[model samples]
Target: MIKLYGMTGSGNCWKPAVLMKQLGQPFEWTEINTLKGETRTPEFLALNANGRVPLLIVNGRKLAESNAMLCYLADGTDYFPADRWQRAKILEWMFFEQYSHEPYIATVRFWVHFMQKQEEWKDKIAEAMKKGHAALGVMEQQLQKTSFLAGARYSIADIALYAYTHVAHEGGYDLNAYPAINDWMKRLEAQPKFEKMTG
Candidate 1:
């Protein structure tokens, strides 16, 4: 059986859970509370040197990194395209989500919602908001032209961005400003077997 170790509230962790459900893959989930320093423990470190949640253990092989796990799970499936260029395009958006979008958007969400350090991290939050909005603007532009990030079809690229983008309001981002993104989100939610984040 496949096993996942993660906090349900984390968007990164929630990514694979939603995908697994959508793909009809059965798995066991074990919650690890990072806020309580569970991830820093030696046992957790042995599974992931980076000491992060969203670790996937399959047949004794452990995989770290949510996006990497997504690629692994979605490979050869409709979520990952068969066409070389189309796959590359999906990867492009996935990479952008990690580098440009997650840093600011997810970070602020972590700070404001999880840590409740909005005042303590005011300066940092302000900076993240600016950069996060910029990332959203980029997404808005692409979403304006295409139904999905890679193209008309939904892919892991959409899943990657949707994980954080949907709950961006937790970080104080206003979705009302991005009509295309809102529409795309609605479209994604309308997908069959779609699951909401657990926490």
Candidate 2:
């Protein structure tokens, strides 16, 4: 059986769990409390040198990085796609999520929601929100042209971006302006076997 080690409310950790559920693949979950420093322990560090959650153990081999897990689990599945160009496009959005989107959106959410730094770190949060909104604008532009992030069909690219975006409000982001993104999110939520992330 596949084993996943992750924190309950983390969007990065939720990515693979959602995919596995959609695929009807049963897996064991081991909760890691990042707030309690569980990820930094020697045992956890031995499994993943980076000391991050969302670690996967499959057939005795361990895999780290949430996006990498998505790609691995979705390979040859409709989520990953077979066309080279389509795959490339999917990867394009995945990379964009990690670099442009998650850093701003997810980090701010962590700071404001998890750390309760809304007032304490107001200035820093404001700056990050600018970049987060920029990323949302890019997503909105593409979503206006395509039904999904990569193209007409839903893919891991959507999963990658959706993880943080749906909960962007927690980071004090106003999604009311992005009509296209809202619609796309509704479409994604309606997919078969789709599971909502748990807190």
Candidate 3:
């Protein structure tokens, strides 16, 4: 059986869980509360020295990083195309998500929603939102052209970005400006077996 360690409501953790469910892959979930310092425990560190959630353990082999889990679970499936150029295109968005998108959007959401630092970190949050909007603009430009982030097909690239973009409002982002993104999100939600993230 595949056992996954993750925190509830976290976009990063939600990524693999949603993919596994859509792919009909059965897995066990073990919740680790990062806010409570659960990830710092020695036992958890043994599984992943980085001490992060969304750790996947299959057949006693452990894997860290949420995107890596997506790639591994989606392998040999349409979610990860067989075509070399298509695969590269999908990876391009995934990499952009991690570096350009998530760092700003996801982090701001974490600070505002989870930490409740909206008032305390107003200036910092404002600065981050600038970058977050820039990231969103970049996505808007691409999504305006393609039905999905990677291309016409729904792939893990969409899954990666959707995890955070859908809930960006909790971080003070106003998605009303991006009509294409709103439409794209609706399309993703309509996907078969799609489930919203839970806290």
The C-alpha RMSD in Å for every predicted model, in order, reads 0.8, 0.5, 0.6
Candidate 1 — which pairs collide?
none
Candidate 2 residue lDDT tens string, 1-199 = 9999999989999999999999999999999999999999999999999999899999999999999999999999999988999999999999999999999999999998899999999999999999999999999999999999999999999999999999999889999999999999999999998877878
Off by over 4 Å in 2: none
* Runs off by more than 4 Å, candidate 1: none
Tens-place lDDT per residue, model 1, 9-91, is 79899899899999999999999999999999999999999999899999999999999999999999999968999999999
Off by over 4 Å in 3: none
Cα lDDT over the full model 1: 0.93
TM-score quality measure for candidate 2: 0.99
- When sorted by TM-score, best at the front, the candidate numbers are 2, 3, 1
Given candidate 2, what's the lDDT at residue 71? Answer: 96
lDDT of 2: 0.96
* Per-residue lDDT over 1-199 for candidate 3, one digit per residue giving the tens place of the 0 to 100 score: 9999999989999999999999999999999999999998999999899999889999999999999899999999999988999999989988999999898999999999999999999999999999999999999999899999988999999999999999999898999999999999999999999998877
Sort the predicted structures by lDDT, highest score first. Answer: 2, 3, 1
Model 3, residue 134: C-alpha shift (Å): 0.6
Q: What's the C-alpha lDDT at position 135 in model 3? A: 92
Prediction 1 TM-score vs. true: 0.98
